[model samples]
Target: MDANTISHILLPIDFSESSLNAFETGVAIAQKNNASVTIIHVQDNTFEYDHTNLHGNHKIEDNFGDVLNALADAAQLKLGKVPRLIMGEGPITASIVNTANKYSCDLIVMGAHGASGYRELFIGTNTYKVIKYASCPVLIIPTKKKFKQFNNVLFPLKPLPGVLKKYDLIRCMTSNNQETSLEILCLSSKINDDDEQLFEYLLDEFKERTEGVPTKVSSQYSFGNNIAEIILKTAEELRSDLLLLTPSIDISNKQFFIGPYTQRILHHSKTPVLVIKRNN
Candidate 1:
């Protein structure tokens, strides 16, 4: 019911329009929870690691601070406080992941460039690069997507056990309004008898937890070979504002989280996707 669930949020921006659009989402989340926000911009300067040129790097960061300060000033209008800024130097994705880990950020909100009309790293593949390596949850907001209330959510999960540990995270991301609701999409790759039972059980378990909460929760079971495609279709039909994924699969396991299944959803989903890190 409160942003206390999120203490600090890390935002990586490139000054691109898409990145600027994501600024609203990151700031909005901070404003909601009274949480602190840190805005980071990574510059892939080749000579950054040269200790001899440390002074030059410092000068560059000082210049970057000027722009970051302007951005912080603008964000203050919505955040009600000046956000801390970090001028990172290194590879785009690595810098982002390392900064989040170093600062102990609870969440990383970044922009996702659309299918066509691409600009740079935060687009198609590079964005996923950061998502796969981040220590915390990564929320991808599309360039054209509008920032609105988090009343409706679409959560998809497998029948695997121990995947519901972050159900509380889902609740915190949504509002407490009466009309606020969580839609659970029970996804199955086939019509196996055991998986079907587990699907129903997962749905009912979450549904029961909404009894006294301000949000209404409902679920639907879906069977298909192409689970990702089915999920995208369901999200469109429900007009979901956010797509939440909590997989039992670990990032390092033979069954990869960045495999084709999750990759398709993150790359193509029209709605924003919140990928909860396993260790988070």
Candidate 2:
């Protein structure tokens, strides 16, 4: 279905600046589509502290509930539409994904905080987990309001079925062709003569897919030391608004993509990355 058909959206709020960025973006989309939003605060009730015979578990639980309610109430007031608040005990990322599915949410708007090195391994970013696991479409609002016009989108493609099948996700963002311009960008590490012809053929196919729309299609192949850095640099050169990719990263050992560059992109790119799952 089209964006206008979205009737209900799930927006998770943590009261952080990033979450607020997500909330504002969600509000605008909800208003445009006349969709109601459910603001969720996933409280991780697993905090460990020096419980040296000082406090009881019941008291801590009550305190947690109180904080959640206050946050929820404040969010309800801020939103143009009254929102539903849900409180649960578990991992924040898993909780939000389950709740979104339980409520049959059409979309999920969230904040993305890029992580680096050891921290990213031990404590995963909630936005990364949500995008990796969530069933609905997720709009990742950047830390800063660095939203450029989508006249040129840096779509880093790979030889994966999910990447090609995920045209639906890109379509959702660029559905409103009247206001936005969409482009399909394919980034290749190495280009053979045959690959060039194949890439050109795929560009033609993408053009047909976005037929009768105010959109441009392009492809590029870069041979370099760091592919993610190259992609980001190219996007900066073009002044792109968004970057699209599968949530798959490519660390040397734990590659999200086939190669060892996805992690680099996730950690370093300033561009807003739309990380979709295999099924999404």
Candidate 3:
């Protein structure tokens, strides 16, 4: 994210505290980047209606539009910029994606909870859906918290096939000015005993490629600690600005963010998380 360019920003508000946190973060980002925001509210009134009642359904739909308008007006005032509040008759996730594409938003900001089981299974998390479908970057703010300056960033990379290529892109993204110094931390828990030799080569290659970038590449072999736990602990100790990693969507197309480790982190950690999704 450059300091000067903001193109467009999409914010999904559900009136939840998490959503409001995301909205405030979006406002700060947009204000800094000089970008405008679009707020979207989807009305799910049909869930209360008796399917057989046709006349009652029409009234519900009409009232839904009115609710959207009111929410939009209130949001616009809070954002300090008039936002386009869009309403459509459908599921939340689909409507959000459709509205974002319609406006060509460059970034999507939303909140997520540590939901589990049937609730997540049936409703399909709006944040997860938006991340999978949005054409641009998505930033997930966990709760109502102010963003700390991102001085150090933990970027975990496995030698998975295309990992290097994505690492290259991340290096470029983190290479900002000297004031915002970023330390790139990479770790590997598997030990080959001959791992030092392999890492020597990998380290040299990364350094050579990231020359002009103001970043220090640190590498380590995970020592008896869980991968995600190590990451969370490290970030907490360093007070990192954000946790940057790539999520590999599994066969179910669900984001396997370090399996349940990510869920645990989100449930407990205060640090913001930035996930870069890449397709092979």
lDDT, candidate 2, at 77? 59
Give me the runs in candidate 3 sitting further than 4 Å from their true place: 1-6, 46-83, 114-124, 132-135, 160-178, 193-220, 223-225, 248-268
Against the hidden reference, what TM-scores do the models get? 0.83, 0.71, 0.64
Q: How accurate locally is residue 216 in candidate 1, as Cα lDDT from 0 to 100? A: 75
Compare candidates 1 and 3 on lDDT and give the better one: 1
* lDDT scores in order: 0.72, 0.60, 0.58
Cα lDDT of candidate 2 equals: 0.60
> Model 1 TM-score?
0.83
| Number of the predicted model whose TM-score against the real structure is largest | 1
Give residue 30's lDDT in candidate 2 (0 to 100).
61
Error of 2 at 155 (Å): 0.9
Residue pairs in steric clash, candidate 2? Answer: 248-256, 249-255, 249-256, 249-257, 250-255, 250-256, 251-255
Candidate 1 residue-wise lDDT at 205: 83
TM-score quality measure for candidate 2: 0.71
Would you list the rank order by lDDT, best first?
1, 2, 3
